[model samples]
Target: MSEEEEVELLLTELFDWYGYDFTNYSRASLKRRIIRLCSLDKFTSYVELRYRIRTDTDYLKRFVEEITVNVTEMFRDPLFYRTLRTDVIKNLAAKPFIRIWHAGCSTGEEVYSMAILLQEANLLQKSLLYATDLNPSVLEKARKGLFPLSQMKQYSENYIASGGAQDFSKYYTAHYGQAKFDTMLAEKMIFSMHNLVSDRSFNEFDLILCRNVLIYFDKNLQERVLKLFDDSVGPLGYLALGAKETLKFSSIQSKFKQLNKEKIWQKIR
Candidate 1:
């Protein structure tokens, strides 16, 4: 069979056997990731890779992690967070209760960052941050709120650039090369597994952040996911995307007004 055919078969098996639907993902991206996984695992043939993935549950977890985009950090784009601080959070502050969904929240860094922003605005007490990812392992890590201490310096700089005035070190305590964030920051967070490809909207949100994730999806999947977001967000709610993602020509374009300087949009209809 051709490599492309093999891949199609594998995606079908994954959905049928594991209930993970990746058929609509970008073919180029999936091929590259599968190739890399094969090389990294030293598979003698695609058959070997396929067999291991089909029979071994442990290996399947690793396979899913490898295929999905999970790289994330706190305040990834300082200017984006700055805009959230200056524009989005301020508008949300007036609501008696705020619901923010972090779709594909990898490892919870950005969710913690949002918690800090709300805390600074005195809105944390009234806000609920729903953080979801397809990978359960990452969600478990996110629940702990621990990250490498070495990353704090960069995150601290990002915090300052994003208009933060307090000592960033105060947010976490470092021990043995690991930084454990304050439990308070995690108290308002709800971490769970959600697959955007097949999951339906669960709650109406005031703000939805799905940064840098749509790039891995094909146009059709992106449109479907965007519509799911449209249904999930209340009128006047904000939708945040990654730097490269946009709603310009999507099905929901007319309903959202894009912020001029950032990849954020507010629902108008």
Candidate 2:
């Protein structure tokens, strides 16, 4: 079989056996990630990797962790949060209550970032955050709200750059090299398993933040996910994407207006 055919079979087997669909992911990036995984696992061939993934639960878990790609930090791309603080939050204040969904919220750093923004804006008491990810392992980490204490300095810098008004250190307590965030910040958050691929939209949201997640998806999957976000957001609600992502070329592009030239879109009535 050709190399292309072999990779195709591998992806098909993964979906059929594991129900985790990478069939719609960006082909080049997915291929690179899988190849890296194969090297890390010391597999001589794709077939060997497939066999291990099929029969070995531990191997499969590692495969999922590697492919799901959890490279994220608290208040990542600080300017994005600054935009949210100044523009999105200001516009949302007229509403009596708000619901924000952080889709594909890996490890909950961005989730906590949004929570902190809301808290600083005095909107936390009136807001509910829905943090969802397909990977259960990352979701568990997010639920714990613990991060390395050494990373707090960087996170604190991000917070300040993102328009944080108070001492960022006040939000967490460090112990044993880990910083556990204030439970009060998470009080209004609901973290759960949500697959953008197979899951149906559950509620209308005032704002949906799905940053840095769609770059992995192919055009078709990106359009489908964008449509889901469009349908799930209430009239005039806000939608934010990664700096490199946009609503252009998507079927729902006409449904939203560019709130920020840097990939933030607001639902148009």
* Winner by TM-score: 1
Estimate every model's Cα lDDT from 0 to 1: 0.95, 0.88
Give me candidate 1's TM-score against the actual structure. Answer: 0.99
TM-score of each: 0.99, 0.95
Q: Report how far residue 158 has shifted in candidate 2, in Å.
A: 1.1
RMSD of each: 0.7, 1.3
Candidate 1 worst ten-residue window by lDDT: 44-53
Clashing residue pairs found in predicted model 1:
none
Where model 1 places Cα greater than 4 Å from the true spot, the runs are none
Q: What is the lDDT of residue 223 in candidate 2?
A: 85
Which pairs in model 2 have colliding backbones? none
lDDT (Cα, tens digit) per residue for candidate 2, span 49-127: 8888899988887787788878789989988888888889889988999999999988999999988888888899999
Model 2 TM-score relative to the real fold:
0.95
User: Mind giving the per-residue lDDT tens digits that candidate 1 earns over 1-269?
Assistant: 99999889889989999999999999999999999999999997778987998999999999998999898999889999999998899999889999999999988999999999999999999999999999888899999999999999999999999999999999999988999999999999999999999999999999999999999999999999999999999979999999999998899999999886899999999
